[model samples]
Target: MTDKAGIHPKYFEYCYVAFVAFLLLSNIAATKLIEVPTPWTNLVFDGGAILFPLTYILGDVLTEVYGLARARKTIITGFALSILASLTFWLVQLAPPAADWHNQEAFEAVLGFVPRIVAASLGGFVVGQLLNSVVLARMKQRWGEKNMWTRLIGSTLVGEGADSLVFCTIAYYGIITGGTFLNYLIVGWAYKVAVEVVLLPLTYAVIGAIKRAEPAYSPQAWAQREAVRAAR
Candidate 1:
């Protein structure tokens, strides 16, 4: 049978692996809040903020090159793996330490999974990633393949906005003041979007390379090919 929709790309597995790695690492890093000294002022943000944006970039690449179905699968896989990681960490925290182990407190401080934070992370991830993929797919359908920047930026704005708002509110509502929480939301959202914008050229190069290297998976591209085949 002919491969329709290019569902299985040559490099899809690699992308999936990278996506999951970024997601898991981001979750681990998010446990800490780091302060960055800037020329203008000190910036306080979660440690994950530095690397989490890469997931969105990867998400964009997945949706843009491999189509929404594949992107959705990757997103769901990442979500599941993240949950598994959290559960494993929680279990580890519960397990008794050896008598010689002197760093149990530090280990717990670093790896313990707080229920509220875990919920926030999972909830925000699902909402943000689903929205990101859906928006990019719909926008591609509406706009065709002409404007990559529009969809990337537009989707990131909405997707990251939802993610930041949900995560910050849920994770820090009681721990930090409302104002500070809002700042976190805004800063995180802006930083993520900015990361995508700054990396647009690299994104373009990667997408272009993937498109050239793989069979067409995008709905529009596949439909167009099918139409031509039918005409002949």
Candidate 2:
């Protein structure tokens, strides 16, 4: 019964809470459209993309600070939570609007969940996140955990590509033909990856700071070690 990481077990619980919150919020926020003054008017994106990239930052933190297994587990937890949220939202949308509600139409318009979209989202997330975690863990091992930039960006290339392509194709393929789907795919991929690129310095700072604050071979580490072992 040696203490893993020489710290309390509760921190792992806290990390899981943070991970779930970031993920759920990202999904909810993605539905809302907020216009920003980008160079291109047609290339609009939802607010959720802004926050969604932070999950990668979190991914980096999880792998760098706790190692790969814990990070992968967190990703899986996020995947399940995302699916649950989509299913719950779809159920909510199926219920008829009350006559007394003034904003029923508006609510449905914003909060509605389409099954195909949900499936695409869930599928893309699972594949992209799994790829991200695997690449990150292996990169960390190969690179001695020093080059944070290389790992974060490199993993995003694979993860974001999978996410953008799967989501865009599954969600909008037949609906948007020819160049439109391609544009959407490109925009989504670029926007998401750009967010990660911009956040690199901040990610490094946060990961470094968190690693410094954590203890070694405590419950969190043991839990994380177990996760990595399972993934391998």
Q: Pick the candidate with the highest lDDT.
A: 1
Alpha-carbon RMSD, each predicted model: 3.1, 4.8
lDDT of 1 by residue, 30-83 (tens): 878766777975566787887889889889998988779889989889888877
- Could you tell me the lDDT of residue 41 within candidate 1? 59
Q: For every model shown, what is its TM-score relative to the native structure?
A: 0.89, 0.80
lDDT of 1 at 152: 93
lDDT of 2: 0.73
Clashing pairs in 2: 4-217, 4-218, 5-216, 5-217, 5-218, 6-218, 69-228
Candidate 2: deviation at residue 188, Å?
1.6
